[model samples]
Target: MTHRRRPNDRLRTLLKEADWTQEALARAVNTLGAEIGCPLRYDRTAVAHWLSGTRPRHPVPQLAAEALSRRIGRPVTPEAAGFPVPWREPAGEDPVTGFAALCRSDAETGSRLVLQQRPYRVADARAPSPPALPEIPAQRPAADRDPASPGPPQAGAGGPELAALHDAARFFAASIDTHGGRHARSALSTYLADDVTPLLTAPRPSPSRREMLGAAARLAFLLGRMYEDGQLHGLAQRYYTYAHRLASEGGDRATWSLVIRAMSAQAQRLGHLSSALQMGDAAARAAQGLAPSQQSYVQAQFAVILAQTGERRGALSALATAERAAEHAACGQGGSPFDTYPRAALLFQTSQVLEALGDLPGAIGALRRSAAERAEADVRGRTLTHARFGQMLLRTGRLDEACAAWRRFLSGRERLRSGDAERALREMRRALRPYRNRRCAAELLALSVPLTEHS
Candidate 1:
């Protein structure tokens, strides 16, 4: 037989068993909030709500459980508080339940399930709120000690180890973007399994150690995204799994969102509309209660994923919401990496969704906006946007416009690494295939020569 318990009773039982007074619980919650840059203000009434069967918002429940667990010197989970198990989905469940289930699924299976499902409805993709974006403190020392620090330290010296890990992660991420995962998958995976995982599982975990783990997780996630981009789903899934575990240990929601975004992207690419939508929904839910910048990031990604799943209208709506949230985040008084929500990135994402939806005019408009916002130093981003725009123009039978776009794109390719520039060129050639040997096509082909020579 199944057991049913009231939310209040659960809270009371946990408090009694742990011997914590309401005041004590409130203090712990507030303290943790402060550490994570959340500035939470819980009182007896909040605890009363728990007893009265009201579920706290996203992140709060997890926060309370973690805080209580630390106080009692044991691990506590959300399940203990009378809510449904996190990330589990029942067969034939609602969109929310299905989305949760996708998150709970192991990375490999989850990715495959997402890829196999195809085309989600926009109505089913709505999220209760935006994703979590942590408010990183202005001072490095203060930020490091903030309860919001996601993971523990590596087994060795904390500060240096984390710095090394972050540097390494950034290096690998750059390599993946330049060379593609197919060329470096084995080496990347070995780094995760051999070098990174050991540090994560080592004894005597410290704050620095956790930070290293988080860095490693991000690297693994980038590898996964690279693999996904290269159309290697199987390899991508493995990397995502490692990344997710590391993120969990580090307790970095941003890292976790990164992994989920990669997984969702793979699903969308493979035509698993329902599954992709489900993953996007979960990501949106997970990000709720985060800083405005963080919310903007998640919402923007959600918009892209929804568009990939064929939810054109829903996708547009999501894009609008993302823009508004980002504006709010930019205006808010706080310091964080979250504040680096690139306007170019948002416009680029909007262009992608519009292109997928076959809205050429809309896509072109977004791309123009993206190009305008892109800094000259961001050569790679500019090249990518130009290539995409050129292809879109080619598709819509605007030969002259397409040629102009390709020429402009090629001009920027000189500053980029050879591999990406070549890839962009190849894509441009493919888009120009139908008009091969034609005047416009030949002119475009001539422009490609100089770019190739420079590479």
Candidate 2:
């Protein structure tokens, strides 16, 4: 059979421009991948495959472009590598079916082979995002929902109401903070399949339809959060995308902005700072007409991106705006049942910005305040705060104080399932490496064994 697809002419041209052979290019790509901690062991054979139009998965394509760009002394993109840009999925498609299918597959197969690469956090220049969804639907009159339905809604008369579905989601959300996502992910997934998905398609009177949409929208967001907590970033991204569309369908502008902002958060996790910044800016704009609480949340998120990008002035400005919005929002609705951004949340965010800006003392002060008043249910959040505080202390040569903070974090065994917790433990060991022979270091290392096991 004749090979008919276009050869990677662009890649070939770039290789010639850089004065390199296929083997040379493969070595460069693998070298760059290792530097970034991605183990892309592409050989000359792999390069031959790509040149024949076989697409490489994510960061490899990205890594290849970077390698060529550096070699040629010019910017190179995945498109320039004769590869489709990494992860150019149509963004505006209805994500429910895809999202639900993924949830079920993960739950059943126990193997997430479909998510071969983590979703890209930021948009690329090649393919455009899907056409934007229209304005949020107008809120219609809603029946007072019954918030106590323990089971899936019944089909007809006197059936469990939409409010119960919403409430059940809320119950799971409440447990997530204290118990960690791994602790509750199975139950949340089951709820999504059994309780939430059914009501989403269940026939409802037009009057009660608004409430159902709202409940489903919230459930999608909560599921996304749970996925994030469990470090399943790709799945979280999908759920957030679906939730945003659902919010638009229901005219839930408040949550629509939050969901968009959530995608930004996931992008930040993936270290796509610029992409996260773009998402945050868009979310802040979309949230302008929303409640102060919503504005507060987005502003803090924008600050995080700014901080990561080294925009100190911009970050501080956004942080102040977030504080003002948080105050105003506190005077109003106080919190969303779907997510929270209390004072402690703001303080923790401030520490991150300050830390990024190299104000270690200022970061420590903010973290101390955050830890002092963190909410009880925010177990993972508090654990992170403790870990950060400890890391900072250890970095500053205050070993004993750092040990205290690590102890505080380790005490929360329930939160150990999170990747963040594991990183914190690693940081502690690395920090204590110099004093490895010290009694305190040995004690600290011993206490962290259980953490390593869980992590």
lDDT tens digits by residue: candidate 2, 129-223? 32233332244112222121112333542246665775677686667677766566667766677666666566767435544665676778887
Off by over 4 Å in 1: 1-157, 173-195, 206-209, 229-231, 308-313, 331-339, 356-358, 411-426, 446-455
Across 1-455, the per-residue lDDT of candidate 1 in tens digits comes to: 12233656766888887888887888777765533324478987777776667776544665577566765766666667554444422446432223223333323443433332211122222222322444453544543433333433334546665666666665665554344444454565555555555555566445555566567767767666655544445435545655665666556676666566556665665455665677677776676655556667777878988777678788888888888877876663332232346688788888888777878799899998898888655666777788888888777788888888888887776555534456678879877777877998887876676665542
By TM-score, who's the top model here?
A: 2
Instruction: State the displacement of the C-alpha of residue 173, model 1, in Å, after optimal TM-score superposition.
Output: 4.2
Off by over 4 Å in 2: 1-93, 110-113, 116-160, 205-207, 331-336, 414-416
Q: Residue 284 in candidate 1 has what lDDT? A: 67
Tell me each candidate's RMSD, in Å, in order.
Answer: 18.5, 6.6
* Worst-scoring 10-residue span by lDDT in model 2: 141-150
Number of the top lDDT candidate: 2
- For model 1 the local lDDT of residue 379 reads 65
The TM-score, computed over Cα atoms with residue i paired to residue i, of candidate 1 is: 0.59
- Model 2 TM-score on a 0 to 1 scale: 0.74
